[model samples]
Target: MPRPGARDPQAPVATADVSTAAESMPRGQRSAARPIPALTLVSHPTAARIGERLLLQGLLAGREVALSRNAPDFTRPGEPLGLPLGDPFLSRKPVLFVPVGEGVRVVPGDEGRCTCAGEPLHGGREFGPEELARGVPLEFSGRTVLLLHLAPPPEAHAPASLGMVGQSAALHGLRRHIERVADVDVPVLIRGETGAGKELVAQALHARSRRGGPFISVNLGAIPKELAAAELFGSVRGAFTGAQRDREGFFRAAQGGTLFLDEVGEASPEVQVMLLRVLETGEMYPVGASRPVATDVRLVAATDADLEAQIADGRFRAPLLHRLAGYELRIPPLRERREDIGPLFLHFARQELEALGEAHLLTPSDPYAPPWVPAALAVRLLLYPWPGNIRQLRNVAKQLVIGSRGQSFLELDARLAQELRLPQTAPHRTPPPGAPTPAPAPEPEAAARRKSTEVGEEELLAALRAHDWDVKKAAHHLGIARSSIYDLIERSPSIRLAGDLSVEELTLCFHACGGNLDEMVRRLEVSKRALNRRVKELGLVPKDA
Candidate 1:
């Protein structure tokens, strides 16, 4: 978003909430624009396309709404939206979508294959208006995924491709803004949080513009103060210490194209004057050049900082701000568009998996097993307050793909949990005086034990190494059951059990590591528990405990 990337002339882009895009409509149009219950396809058994909506306004006339395997009344998206899901694994019985007073009740069929929020749906579950507003994910037969959310009625014109993904209304609004101003030949001031994908919006503007020049992007905050002027404008040879020849700076490089300046608020006072001159007169003076050079480049600047505060502090020039903000595009934070999380995740996962020739990971195994990306994880992704925005979500997608390599299913390790900032300890709150006594809480867990869910592959390996391959000690230290730890080892393709090692190999490694079980664990990569037992059975002299 430059706040969700769209044009709204009525309000300042900085303060506009993209979620309330429909609120701006006239009284008559507002009723037509009011969001109604809808289901958008996220994934299909055989197709990767998404974002086709199944509006319920026309389909549900205050009665029951049905989503069966053979439902043929609805419109199709990328896949046969009016499917049989084309998934042979799906049950013949249909899942009912009954509209209650304000919320919709999802009644799972007898097969019990549906899941949401990381739990299997065995019975009817009602999604409140609030939950549906944020969007609820429903998985069928471990293959098809549909997001149940509130969406406005269909528009006469579909959104043009601006390289943005998702079916959220905010995204639609953003497209509207970009389409309106892309070819107006005006400097665009993009305001958004860091990692909110401001540069993507800038690119979209350029892509949609009439200019045929290349897009040049640079981070104003990253450029050194001394080099800022020379970098933006050209420098003649012998003008500076590093200048051996005439330099074509960003302005000239992007001639007739768009130049995106990220973190524009960080521009120094000196550079500010230069920018002001360029905007005022369409001419710039290079650091060591004698004459002014005219540039036809479109200017797009982005910043997450409060420029008004900087203006009050006398750091940034107000005149420069006026020039850069010919048009404003505000990008909404990731938290505002939770419905897009699932589709965005799949988009990223597919890219990474396909690149590594592990595209098969995109599909679940046999019907009984879970999907590669767990529903709980998807819900967590939606719930997480991503301060880093879309950039953070992309990182998580890459982590899941690389971390789950060679495994049948992805595991939630400690590192990922910490990164997502998922709650670890239950913080005790002081009860008010004279309040009724609360029920006793469960026993406190071990002080420093590492549970299976809390330990990542590397962390688990390190714990084993620290405990010298003693499974019991490691299990105790990890606060996990020994059997569960063994299961973790069994699932790890990189780790080996003592049984897999030959007696000769064990004896040779025993001498190689000088019978140091810890060292042996590192070299053999076998379970310390099994290795220790083998050492005992071999009757080797017990050196250290």
Candidate 2:
């Protein structure tokens, strides 16, 4: 005999007796169990229609089963599930799945009571048509219940950190300068050649200032002239024809924080006057606004141009220069700090690999090794005169990593030179027949012939070149004053010799030889005073030279 609740094999509805008087009962009223077929999980409207076809086929064929309305049991309850429902041509709905079987029981509730005879069955409640169409899931008892899911929300991302990845003396000096001046709120003037990472230094200052507010930056060179004043100082809603709403200036935006003005030398004279006022009074007036607003911003300015020269030329304000340069920090260019090249190269290469999503290729077990660039390459890098400084170095490294195919040192050098537009071999040249070759020019002979005039000149030029033209070092090497070395370079015969060499050339030689006055003195083979006096006499403009 079959069990009391067991399903019958042949009967559409299982019953204890089939001989009851069915003719006396209404057609629709029958003591029979409604057969339920297996549930079909679907994720698309078309798929759900196919399921309906299967369901209707089973129903019309008098198969002893109907479509199941209960939710399907998922293996991983918390996993996301998408379900589709509704008429094929009229409506469509999407439903999300959340696991809820651990602690909660699926039972008939007042809101979802079934009208079927016998036992009441309730597994899931119906959501709104629109909610069901969107597949947003809900969580219950550590399970994700199918609710509705809309389009995925945008992913949040973090800002990239500043790329200061070297620990060379130059970088250390810059870091120390930032730390020392960060707390004081005094205006800082950062000086460096273009692309020498002056802006990075400014960012470091702002990062360490701990000013408790936003760090706002404005590139004075980029702002348009007509909008410059209004942009920096803001404007009232009706200040101009197109002014639709009141705006806050950079000063107000950077309140209680740091405001970095890049290319400060580019500010218009009128803007300079206003800047001086703000620096002195800590107050600013927006365009068309009568009242002044107080600001507690720390000013940090940067420039590649010599503001003093600008002042002399009547292009930059002298008073403004004095006010802005409360504490000046000069960032040495890449050619001046070749010791930082290897480390900076690795840093940039790693960053490039990561950016390309090929970080795994840079691992320790990888076939390619970062080529050990020879001193020849280093010297070349030093001599190329990186007008773009660290930023350019980073770009070159990135290009090499992206384009290089092998680990051979020569290959790396070739690729680097190609990428940087550098020559693979030093250019070969034949000295002109009558031209005095630099090599045959005897330092001692020149010194002896013009002792009174040449001794000081030779010594100064040698010491200056040896120390990479660093005034203090050259002076110390020759036991003289820094000011004295400057004086001798101004009046030296060697000054004329160096006149042909640009400031960049002298600086490159200085850095390439490790800023050693003794090495430079020996190489040039000139007497100390001769070298010293010559540098002083020449008065070489170190900034431009």
Name the best candidate (by TM-score).
Answer: 1
* C-alpha lDDT (0 to 100) for residue 213 of candidate 2: 78
* Model 2 agreement with the true structure over 502-525: per-residue lDDT tens digits: 455445544544555444343333
Per-model root-mean-square deviation over C-alphas:
19.1, 34.4
Tell me how far the alpha carbon of residue 536 in candidate 2 is from the true structure, in angstroms, after superposition: 6.9
TM-score of 2: 0.49
Off by over 4 Å in 1: 1-28, 41-53, 58-60, 69-81, 85-96, 100-102, 105-128, 137-146, 238-244, 363-369, 421-545
Worst 10 residues of 1 by lDDT: 1-10
Residue 61 C-alpha lDDT in model 1: 66
Which candidate comes out best when scored by lDDT? 1
**Clashes in each model (backbone N, CA, C under 3 Å)?**
17, 54
Tens-place lDDT per residue, model 1, 286-351, is 888879888787899999775765675688898788778878777766766766776777788788
Residue 135 of candidate 1: its Cα lDDT? 74
Q: How does model 1 score by TM-score?
A: 0.67
